[model samples]
Target: MKKFLVPLCLFLASMAYSQDDLLNSLDSTQVDGKTPVTAFKALQIVTLQSTKMAAKKEFYFVVSHRFGTVKDGFDSFFGLDNATTKLGGIYGVTDWLSVSLSRHTLNKMYETGLKYRLARQDDHFPVDIVGYSVADINSFLEKDQYPGLEFKHRLTYVQQLLISRKFTEKLSFELVPSFIHKNLYNPDIERDNQFSFGGGGRYKITKRLSVNLEYMHNFDKPDFYKNPLSVGLDIETGGHVFQLIFTNSQAMNESGYVTNAAGDWGKGDFFFGFNLYRVF
Candidate 1:
């Protein structure tokens, strides 16, 4: 309870000061482009999923690694000594649709999801819209720990709309409206069905390198968990996109990061992570 006191105070203070809602601030800003633009090269911009998808008949293998908190300094090898990894594969069913399955070391979690395009940023559409649905199962729990635990208690689901635009060749921005549901949860700490809004962007610095930044704010998330913030550099090589990231969220999947982010950016409590994707 003592440990949570500080975060609760901070959360209350933030809410009082945050008069402007994040999602409402982003009114439709049209870019000066006549042709359809390729907004980003990768499927995700740091923590926010981008509108990019694999080509039809193409498949992508993903490797994601998140280290422990860097606050422990050299004693923990700057977080390298304790790390969690996620390995997943994504396959394109069609040009506009894709499916994914992955497992993460954290919570012994398994995740599966799909991404489908609803609209493209072109002559007719002002923004690119993609729909994403995901499911998560926590395999780390045991019947011995909780005598009454059930299988449904370990499940979570998420749905999101990824809206993005390529304002210019060097710049692109995205907004994500997310809905998350947990089968079992503590009513006082957090709600069963959670809602969060996220947005991010990529700016091309040079030919093959870009800077990415994103932030997620949960309207219903508890104060013990801080909102997730991520910044990274995307290196676009010929075969893959390598993302070097620093984030306050240790969880790689949507459900974990959205609801259970456990790091505090104010104290340098963050994780060093990377997302690597190889297309075949």
Candidate 2:
């Protein structure tokens, strides 16, 4: 599956490149050489990716963590005993296109993804449209368990269309249509291909602080698992965007969280986490 990385990136990049002519024409939308920077300040509205992208030639490093359920007061050290971490880096291939790679402690997951902007919001456009796709490999699975398990079985793919609108400098909203495919799954438990729709928004509290909310609903997952609902606070400081999070989903990857959100909000099962990004 690693062999598909270059080809997949090239394919998506080409598609983004094809829209260059239209984007160039839209350059006139800028006023006094100033175009709106972004609907949101960070690369993510919460766990879900935002419409933001790294600038041309810029690179971003991100580290994220989600601790165990905070329901247990101090038994688990406030969920500190069972925390998962993800380290990732994204590079801008062009201002409108980017490539990313990340590794997570949970499931030993390795993720490779591409993000491209199809259109940027402006006076003529009502919203920003960005396409993001990711392929994750779970290296935690061992062949000893399932002799039939092949490398292909370890792969999971996700696709999302991020549509966002900035109604004001202090308010912005996004809608996401997401799809996930797992190469290995139990026929009795859930379908191999799953779909979901979600939306998120951010409200600025100050020049450097904002409150964000994100929720996702899976259409095909078992009824036992609840949809993920997350709330977070974003703080901007120089080159760093620091986010403090509270969510019902323990799995941070798109597919993992989408399909197997473990906690239930009704029971006060919540996980605390943070996502930090540094740009260079």
> Which lDDT tens digits does candidate 1 get at residues 1-280?
3664485456335434434432222223344555455677788899678998776898887878899999999999999878898999999999799999999999999999999999888877789999999989999989998689998998999999999998987899999999999997888788889999988999999876899999999999877898999999997555357789999999999888877888999999999988877666
lDDT of 2 by residue, 6-40 (tens): 75455334434332232223223465455753688
Q: What is the Cα-based TM-score of model 2?
A: 0.88
What's the lDDT for candidate 1?
0.85
Task: Provide the TM-score for each candidate, comma-separated.
Answer: 0.86, 0.88
Could you tell me the lDDT of residue 215 within candidate 1? 92
Error of 2 at 127 (Å): 0.4
In the order shown, the candidates' Cα RMSDs to the true structure are 12.3, 9.3
Model 2 spans > 4 angstroms off: 1-34
Model 2 weakest lDDT span, ten residues long: 18-27
Name every residue pair that clashes in candidate 2.
none
